[model samples]
Target chain A: MRLRADLVPQDNLSYQDVVLVVDVIRATTTATAFLEAGASSLYLTAGLESARAFRDDDVVLAGEEGGLKPAGFDYGNSPREAKEAPVGGKIVVLSTTNGTRTAHLAARSAKHVLLASLYNAHAAARLAHQLATEEVAILCAGKEGRIGLDDVYTAGVLAEFLQIMGSYELEDGALTALTTRRAYPDPLEPLHLSAAAQALRQVGLEADVPFCAQIAASPAVGVLEGRVGEALIFKRA
Target chain B: MRLRADLVPQDNLSYQDVVLVVDVIRATTTATAFLEAGASSLYLTAGLESARAFRDDDVVLAGEEGGLKPAGFDYGNSPREAKEAPVGGKIVVLSTTNGTRTAHLAARSAKHVLLASLYNAHAAARLAHQLATEEVAILCAGKEGRIGLDDVYTAGVLAEFLQIMGSYELEDGALTALTTRRAYPDPLEPLHLSAAAQALRQVGLEADVPFCAQIAASPAVGVLEGRVGEALIFKRA
Candidate 1:
């Protein structure tokens, strides 16, 4: 399999058979947690208003606006909270600063889109490699179209898992990510140094960093099913 | 002192007191070499046509179109050639694929602009640190607006040198670069693995890689003076 990792997604990213979108400092981790917690489906909205529009008795609203829980939301973008939420068989409507927007972008060209995080990195890599027809791309949900160190390091973890499953040529971004991932033996070292983690800490969400850094904590893989209106829906695979 | 490394120059980079533009594959190296070889000034153009416009008998035209010397140019983007050229006291008009364009962008906001490469990495970093009043940004001249591993590694080298000069807070990109730089003991290892080096090898310019990888080979620091028409002029500082 041919493999590439875009440290940050851009308008010029080419099509791939399998695309893994990673947002380790919350979005992807939270999404994976929701899936692992037995949520039947997760709808990723681009903004708060769209996510709030899905408010219903059967749906749980979960997301963050500025690293804080939005007003009246069921939960903030906290994986720990997501893991503990009793959402089995219920649909989750989510929106965040970066990850959801990146999912929408990844859905534009890839044959398959899978949400990836340190929480489910191994499982996501295995599923993606098994499903890839030829090319596989790991796209980091960068902060506001910039390379987020947290996401890049998470991409490195997924890239490492993918390489272990098979022989694949690595791109520049992939090589950089691998180098970074290898440098920090502890996941929290790099993750805590990231702007994302610092932002979370500034908002009294410091616990989320360690929770998000738990590598392979979940075997669940959140695979993009299809788009329903403005939200891209994901289901456990 | 505040230090930041932009692995790839983007639209969102904030203002900095000093900006060091690095294009390790060839551009900045060649420019530095020309100044070291006693060239009076180097004019950086964004394209081939503008470089050709400076076709005066006294001016030496140098640049690469696609990893190869362009037709009618005095030399390709080769630091080795620049070192040996009889460009003493003569003006050299240069245009390159990525480096010159990045310099133009850097000139837009920086109080001081310096060309950096492994050839003059130490001097460039020192000069930048000395010239900076508040923030210093190392801008990597990435390949076609994408992160080039060679440039990123070069940025790391510069960042390392800057850190040695004093204590400076690092941004995420700067931290990533420092990690990458620390991982490679030999500069040629990462440089050879880069897509930029692969392209150069494909075009039979493999010799340029080692030449560009020579750390601190030259003490010459190319400082941007001002612009002349479509070209940004650099002089030895």
Candidate 2:
């Protein structure tokens, strides 16, 4: 099997096979934390109207624009904020710059859509390996419309793990990733860092990067089984 | 300037600053050699009929399908066959897995499009850098529809040159190319053994790998002026 990576546009979610949506600077990490906290489900939408629509009935309306949580929303794309409290029973609506669009695109071409973060990377890779039929594609939430190193680096973490476990061959992108993984002589530093990581640090979320950088900390695999209201929830398809 | 690498479908060749249409194994190498021979102007078409349409005293129908040159063609996709004579004054119509499609794609996006190979890499990079307008994309033609390492490696060579010159900042897929270039301790050894390189060697073109591998050899860059019949020729636009 082969792996392909694309820095897709907000509307151009062109993909096939299993689409692994990554917004490592925060979206997926935050969502994983929300799942860990206690949120029963998440409503992932491209627009704020969807979050506002679901603002009632104990819903935590959440969204991030340019990395910061917007006004009036209960939360932003903060993994710590999401994981800090117990959300096991509440529903959270979420949105962000790159992650949300990736979710929508994955839905268009995937047999199964999955959300991956450093937190639950191993489970994500293993599950993808278990269920993948033809090939595996990891779509990074590149900053805006441009490709960023952080997401690709995060994708490399998962892509490499999957490659080793499944003995899969990779495309040039994935190979470059594996090579990048080896580039940083420092084992402590991540293969790459995201703009969101820097922003979170500025907002006094300094502890977030290491947490965000922790690969496969969560063993849970988040799959986009269905869209509830507008949020996508992780479930077995 | 931003540098990026893309794996586009053979059909989609329209959005790039400088398209490095890579048929690393054969197509492009043969075309480059054909240009070295005395071909006046080459014709690049989507099908064999288009090539035959231009087949006459003025044009030489040259291409391949499933590796070997098709029957009744003046030559195959072999650089060795092309090198038997000089091609300073004839047009050599062509097509292959990666190069032709890349040419079409570059024609759509690049204000100035150029053909690159190990034969004329230094010149190509210098030309690409000189003509680049804040964005330069290298399109690598993989085998069939896969991401061939040879093209990606070639792209890496270009990226390193771009970075060293301080004229470009790597972005999009090109950043990944940077990773590929740096990943290996020794590039020529492992990469030259890749399947794409092997295919070239099978045709007795093993020496070309070293020539292609040489950091910066020939500095003559091939730019596409316009669609002249079928083949793409390098000319100032």
Of the candidates shown, which would achieve the greatest TM-score relative to the real structure? 1
Per-prediction DockQ comes to 0.68, 0.28
**Model 1 CA RMSD to the hidden true structure, in angstroms:** 1.4
* Candidate with maximal lDDT: 1
TM per prediction: 0.97, 0.82
lDDT of 1 at A211: 94
State how far residue B156 of model 1 sits from its true place (Å). Answer: 1.4
Candidate 1 i-RMS? 1.2
Model 1 over residues A1-237: C-alpha lDDT tens digits? Answer: 778887776766666689999999899999999999999999999999999889999999999989988999999999999999999999999899789888888999899999999999899999999999898898888777667889888988998999999999987888999989998999999999998988888999999999999999899999999888899999999
Task: Highest DockQ: give the candidate number.
Answer: 1
- lDDT score, candidate 1, position B33: 95
Interface RMSD of 2: 4.6
What is every candidate's alpha-carbon RMSD to the true fold? 1.4, 4.2
lDDT per residue, candidate 1, B100-147, as tens digits? 889988999889999999999999999998998898899988887678
Compose the digit string of candidate 2's lDDT tens values, residues A1-237: 767655333353456678777887777888878877877777688888777877787778777866677888888777877888656688888877678877887887788788887688888888888878877888777665555566767777888789777767666556655665666544235423444555666777657677777778887656787876656666422
